[model samples]
Target: MHDRTPHAAAAARYPHQSHASGPLVDVSSPEGGPGQHGNTYVQGFGNLADPLAIDGFLRIQEGRVNQFLQVSDRRAEAQRSALQQAADRLSNIANNIGAILKLEHEAIKKQLQEANAKVDEAVKARDELRRLADGVNWTGSAKVSDQEIRSKWKQLEYNIRSLASVLAKCQTKVPSDKLTRTRLDEVSTAWRKLLVVDDYKNFLIGAYI
Candidate 1:
């Protein structure tokens, strides 16, 4: 379509992502041309003219049908644009989600490292307290906080799985919205003509089907 925006760079990079390509013949009546009840007609279809004159007359006739082609191209291009927009929108959203998940994953890893350090510190302190009690008859409980260390370990485990699940989900969502056609047997009549149907099947409908 002349007035429509050209496909964006990102969309252009994925031309094969479009489910359909090319405009179809519309065969519908023109807006203000001879097809308006045939009141207006091509200039010289019946005239016995020279070759150049016949070509000139054919150009005039072609003008009448050009409207249908233009309108159909515009409509088809609009449909393509809508699908591209959907894919772009979904990808952008998923990318943003992935960025967030990455940050959270880093935070979770840091937390796990800190939790492991705390566990090691607590184990050393408790061992030292037991050694001192055995040497000097001191019987006080160890001061290292076991509950606090376990809580941190539990939180670290939870965050590890949560971050992994988030990344997996983002990966799954980002690539599924692209336009991909597996068949064309049920496409519209005008589109079928462009596809050149043969024996109740359009060759474009994929042989695997």
Candidate 2:
């Protein structure tokens, strides 16, 4: 209980210093930063609030993909149409060729038929000529007598009439096959020679008489 004025004055002046204290926590501790295990941190505060921007981006990407698909489909359709047109053109060409071949075949057949008919008619005419020539029997001798000369002349005249009549029938009929002009000229020359020989023989007989 020995109090003094100096001690009382010291206690009032050092009141805050005597009662205040510091914590015992460590100061040099490792924190979650550059050298720590959790090196990075993320936040949803700026971009997550804007829904319109995200939807617009998605719509743009979808539109680009759909446009590409549409272009591919159009190209494929154009190719198919071109191929179909080519096929149809080929079919038409084939059909036209077949029709032309058929017509050509028919024309050739008709020509052959006409040629055969001509051959048959020519054969019949030749047979008739052969029959006529075979039936005639000239019995006159090669002597200068009035009766023999008259008989030979009459027989020659009859043979000439028969040859003329056969040739007249051939002129009226139409032959389907092609005829050689040279062959007709040769036949005419042969007929003329026969007539000249008969005339000479008759003249000789008349002179002798």
Candidate 3:
């Protein structure tokens, strides 16, 4: 009869096998297989099951994220400062423009006032000249006969010659005396009246001549 125990059965299945004659395979080394290369199984992540390695990677990513956030904040602050500066410049420009406009307005207002004053003065002078002209015309149009005008003209000529002689004598003799001065003023006034009458009679004699 054959032995049927478990160890006798394994010996009967591989009668030529022995522990020392088998090839030794290293499972931990990637070069142990024909298709294996460096880090082929892990895909260069380096031990995905390790907590310390994952934590280090996470900490590096967090550092990068924080650095990016800080850079973004600084850029935003700089932009806000630049915008504020631009706004301040615009405000100053607007104020300067407003001041310029105000000055121009004042200058125009003063010019208008001066123009109005000049216009008023010219109108008053023109009116005064017109009144004087009207008075001369009215005086020339008085209703006097030609005979009367000729007689008045002769009398005025005589008075003018007599007054001129008196004024020449007084100027030579009593030029500074108060009584002589008064008499000279009266004589000058009478001479002016006689001259006015002479001019009127001349206008009347134009038709006769």
Candidate 4:
């Protein structure tokens, strides 16, 4: 029979077994290097270098775009300012022209009134002279000779011709065209010459007497 007891003659030949001990070899390294420590450091490379650099480039591009926008905005503002200034200037010029036109109209009205007054005064004088002459009674002179009467008639005829010349000068014709500044000066000169009536003056003398 086989005995399984712990203390036997075969067990006495081998002592009690224990754990083995030795310096562990680093098999991964060709050259024997330092042993691995408990603490480990790992290094890894991801995509491109600095992500912040790419962000910076984008910001720069954005800045350029913003500068262009600012320039365009300023240009538009300048154009608007110029147009507004021009409009204001034109409006001022229009106002000034209106004022000048108003003054011209008033002046023309006053001139026409003066001209009418002169004409009325002349008519009144003529009428008064005619009435006075009709009221007076004429008597024939006994001493007046035929030659003297003929001489007096000749003088009266000469005076009549002179007065007719004056009346012709005073009368004016309607202007047919729009008068410019230069032409207005000419018209004024012509009007001034029309005020003197030599023919009318001669007629008044004879008719009144």
Candidate 5:
């Protein structure tokens, strides 16, 4: 150990402080501190443990500790800000999804009401046609010609068949193999062949099973 009485005044210059008190100022640096400057050692327990030397070493260590804490605090604050931003983004996304769902629900309800109105119109048309047919007595001399009546009835049958075909297609889900009883109105041969294509198979992935 070496006496530090000479540098006592210099030791008191730093801002950091330490409350440690002991009989040693045993620094780990070599005789010159780990560099090529000069030397610092200890004598017996008295001069080595002088309050000045002890206080100086403690102040230097305190400065290092304070610096590390400052850096750590800055990093912690940055991480907290990042987490808050992520949470806000997720909340906005959730609200947008809810808005979209509400719009879709309203649209579907409107479509249902229109469909009901169309159904009522179709029933009225059928009733009117039945009354007109009853007025033309086939038992006696018919008011309307047989050929004209046959043509009209055939047209009505064709319309009914077309409607049935459309309904069958709408009711069936994609991946039709899942159904135990397969039933669908026939389409053109060329259109039916396209169902086996890879593109069609890929398109079916998004469809309801």
Candidate 6:
């Protein structure tokens, strides 16, 4: 007959029984209570009656959990390090870009200054050419002597050559400039006219001599 004691009933009624702990004991039968299998006595609630077995299982679970936590921590640390390295590289790239932009700005400023100087020089050359052209004494009074006319003709020839030279220089400096090209064409036309006038004057002087 099975013991109907409260202690035996409580032990039987305990939860967490499993055949995996060891072979299950048929505690419900009077002939099968507290049966031993090898060195283990697996009772109610699996191996709960054996404190050492329960402790060993808990320790194994604790070790597995700790190992998982360690692996996770290492992975997290590696991720953090990678992120920091990427941030550092980006910062370096940004700094390099800023430096490059600064250098480009300085170079552009220098180029602009050089361009302005060239423009000023070209303008001065154009003004000087205009002044020289205006100073030429092309037509003299009828009272002027032939010798005075010859001297004026010589001076006019020199002045025209100077104008051509100045115009050539201006053209070289601003080859793409439409205004400089137009001025050069005008100067070339005037020089051709002067050549014809020079020939006419020499003929008149030769006849008079």
Assess every candidate by TM-score.
Answer: 0.40, 0.40, 0.41, 0.40, 0.43, 0.41
RMSD of 5: 18.6
Expressed as tens digits, the lDDT of each residue in 123-208 for candidate 5 is 55556568668755657764776686676666555444444333333333334452322321122223334445544432331121
Higher lDDT: candidate 2 or 6?
6
Cα lDDT of model 4 by residue, 122-198, tens digit: 55555544544454355652444557556555554554454443434443443456554345445354433332445
lDDT of 1 by residue, 11-74 (tens): 5667666535454433346564445334424334435545887899889889978987999999
Comparison by TM-score, 3 against 5, better one: 5
Instruction: Give the whole-model CA lDDT for all candidates, comma-separated.
Output: 0.53, 0.54, 0.57, 0.55, 0.55, 0.57
Off by over 4 Å in 3: 1-47, 50-56, 135-209
- Count of residue pairs whose backbone atoms collide, per candidate: 0, 0, 0, 4, 6, 0
Which candidate tops lDDT?
A: 3
Q: lDDT (0-100) at residue 149 of candidate 6?
A: 52
lDDT of 5 at 27: 40
Off by over 4 Å in 1: 1-53, 136-209
Q: Supply candidate 2's per-residue lDDT for 200.
A: 40
Q: Candidate 5: where is the Cα deviation over 4 Å?
A: 1-44, 131-209
Count clashing residue pairs in model 5: 6
Candidate 5 clashing pairs? 1-41, 1-42, 1-43, 2-41, 2-42, 2-43
Between candidates 3 and 4, which one is better according to TM-score?
A: 3
What is the Cα-based TM-score of model 6? 0.41
Candidate 4: residue 65 Cα off by (Å): 2.9
